[model samples]
Target: MKATREAYGEALLDLGRLSDQVVALDADLSKSTKTSLFAKEFPERFFDVGIAEQNMIGIAAGLSLAGFVPFASTFAIFASGRAWEQIRNTVAYPSLNVKVCASHAGITVGEDGASHQSVEDIGLMSIIPNMTVLVPSDPIETKSIINWAFKYKGPVYVRLGRMGVPDLLPKDYSFDTKPYIFKKGKKIVIFATGIMLWKCLEAIELLKAYDIEPTLVNIPCLKPFPEKEIIEIVREHDMVFTAEEHSIIGGLGSMVASTLSRSYPMKVSFIGINDKFGTSGKPNDLLSFYGLDAAGIRDKLLDNIK
Candidate 1:
């Protein structure tokens, strides 16, 4: 059964009651971002800043300046491309305590096609100076990390999805305000992010059939990237495989490969959407079409490595 993004709605609603300073803002996308519950519960704290993403960001920054921990929501495209200048100047430049929650990220936005998909959002946010990037693998992780961001005092851009995904991580799994390590192995490490984590998990199951147990690391916090841990793990492994639902150019796989090539010098098999923009289809159809599914990921990993 497919999970719903609405689970994030349940989680954020619970989080709002726990933090007095928690404020929610939307760029005409409260229902889409699953933040409508946050608005319904905390009417006074929630604000819909119209369709102007740049101005919405300004309002978030202003609210943060007034000591409020603001969580801004919008589709990934607008939040990154539309409000980039405002985000850079108002939130990141000042190192303000603002949280940006971008939903409908990656090609998973489906039938809406590439225009609605924000394939490079992760890369865009991760490169921002002093901006912390968090990409949760599933809805459960999404809630915990969003809650954790409240305690973190800096600008954060968290990527969420419009599509429902399997809960790959355990329900009790929590971010330690630090990177969390899941699978441990020596031959090869499969480091995955976002919805692709589940795909990697399936790949692991297939690899195990051949007795190949690759290490699987989940980097929920992509920025300040668990560099120390990643380096340590890569040193022990013979090769690496990085995967994500976004484009192969700038998403998780590219980030990992670039980091390893310079520092560790190990090979990384990247499994994700190639350079082509995504097309309109069912989410599952898109997954298979874009080679973002588990079986597709398994095929790629198997073909490249032993």
Candidate 2:
């Protein structure tokens, strides 16, 4: 239940039960993205568009126009890049209700390296018009947000991690897509997403050891990055650090800083890739190599706090 695949699988079943209008399309990634649950339960509602990611989105758009709520699934890169034009014109431009469900996002898709990895997917989707991008922190939150996308209008890009993520949400917890503050603090705010939540947890422990009780905000929904909530948190804390396992250019770090500067100004530091392509290393090795681990965050915190 803690793995993202389980949440996607369970939530698709829940969505299928809740709405007769719900239909799914996948580009030969049924097993990977867990859309097979829906495919099995409602074969008629499921469309396996073969390995055609572009056709997948285009068909999903057609389904939307036909009054069916289409949730498209594939690896992040192909969904965003392979079918980006179709998504932009057919879905986003028209403001259609389509959920682009993506998996194996970020460096978490280790060993596969940069080729299969999708470090830029979040930035790519969030920039599109009428797109509500989501990067859920854990399995429970993944379910909550995917359920949110079900009821949410317009186009949505859901970026899901491939690895087994720790459950950061309380059992029987509720989530509002606007903004849900997992932990609050006075000095520093840790705004983290996907794969990097575990790092934030470790940083929290290290910070507590150093008497720096920081706030940890597990930001799954990155596109509509809780604008008001972020500004308030920034004002409440001495400083805020945006952390994610992505390049700082257009990832969570960049998104947070952009929101803060316009809505509310706050001292912010970014903790992520120093604008580089990730190498084919062990996950832990990659994290340490890019200074995105617990110790990396701790060091960045110390540097900025003083």
Candidate 3:
């Protein structure tokens, strides 16, 4: 198992070696955000803004204007909260080649409590007009997404977690801006994002005991949501469910619901943290407490099915 943050750090190092124009900026959380790896390998190309997320974002925007691809790293809460205006006005509005790679996102930022946990980061980032939001499921996908972000011109937000998660994608798996079907079924469909995809896979195993066969989809791209594919998949299933380690309000659930509401609306259920703040605890325990774990997800689906 490997944390997505670790993959991001390694990807940044690879990107640095591939292109000198690739620069990294951090808000004094290099060690935690894992951008320190890039700083170590390419000290001249890295800038530590010293606890100033807003300034870091502005600097990244400037770098982008100067024809450089800048990657800014920070905690999800600070990147999407503290520097929102800078991100909106400086980077996103201009549609600059700036990548905001935020780590320790969602309720999985355990022990740090609500202040550090960013359940609404995806919502905040996705709301921007020119921003492309991405939440990779595992280490391999995280690397692939980072590579994609570098090649794609414009503003992008990549959400990553602190906890180590099991690898769900194959070693040679490449990422696209579309959703990927992990398991195919007919009774119901579950669209999950981030590490929740892993949980949904486990839930599927338990669901089989109850004679429920559900399709599972991994939504890595939250913004520019795979509308056509989602509509097609929803058409194949009787019911739909969206699971994420985020608030059900404006994360994957809300996006999927909005897409389906316009095209193929059905019995859509959400499995996520319902309008609440997280507390200090083990990551897995918090997931279980919020009914986002495998067993909890299975029970929730079964209840709705019956």
Name the best candidate (by TM-score).
Answer: 3
lDDT (10s digit) by residue, model 3, range 1-306 = 989999999999999999999999999999988999999999999999898999999999999899999999999999999999999998888798999999999988999999999999999999999999999999999999999999998999999999998889999989998889989987699999999999999999988888888999999999988999999888888889999999999999999989888887766899998999989999999999999999999999988988
Residue 279 deviation, candidate 3, in Å? 0.8
lDDT of 2 by residue, 203-258 (tens): 87888877998888877777766888778767877778888877788988888888
What local distance difference test score does each model get? 0.81, 0.83, 0.93
- Number of the candidate with higher lDDT, 1 or 2: 2
Q: Give Cα distance to truth, residue 209, candidate 1, Å.
A: 3.9
User: What TM-score would each prediction reach against the true structure?
Assistant: 0.94, 0.94, 0.99
Q: At residue 221, what lDDT does model 1 achieve?
A: 75
The per-residue C-alpha lDDT of model 3 at residue 36 equals 95
- Report the C-alpha lDDT of model 1 over 1-306, residue by residue, as the tens digit: 233346666767887888878888998889898889999989999999889889889999999999999989899888988888888888999899999988888888888987888888887887789998888888778878877888899999988888878776787887764545677776888888888777777778877776778888887877877777788878888878888877788777787877887788777788777777777888888888877787787777778875
Ranking by lDDT: 3, 2, 1
**Which of 2 and 3 is the better model by lDDT?**
3
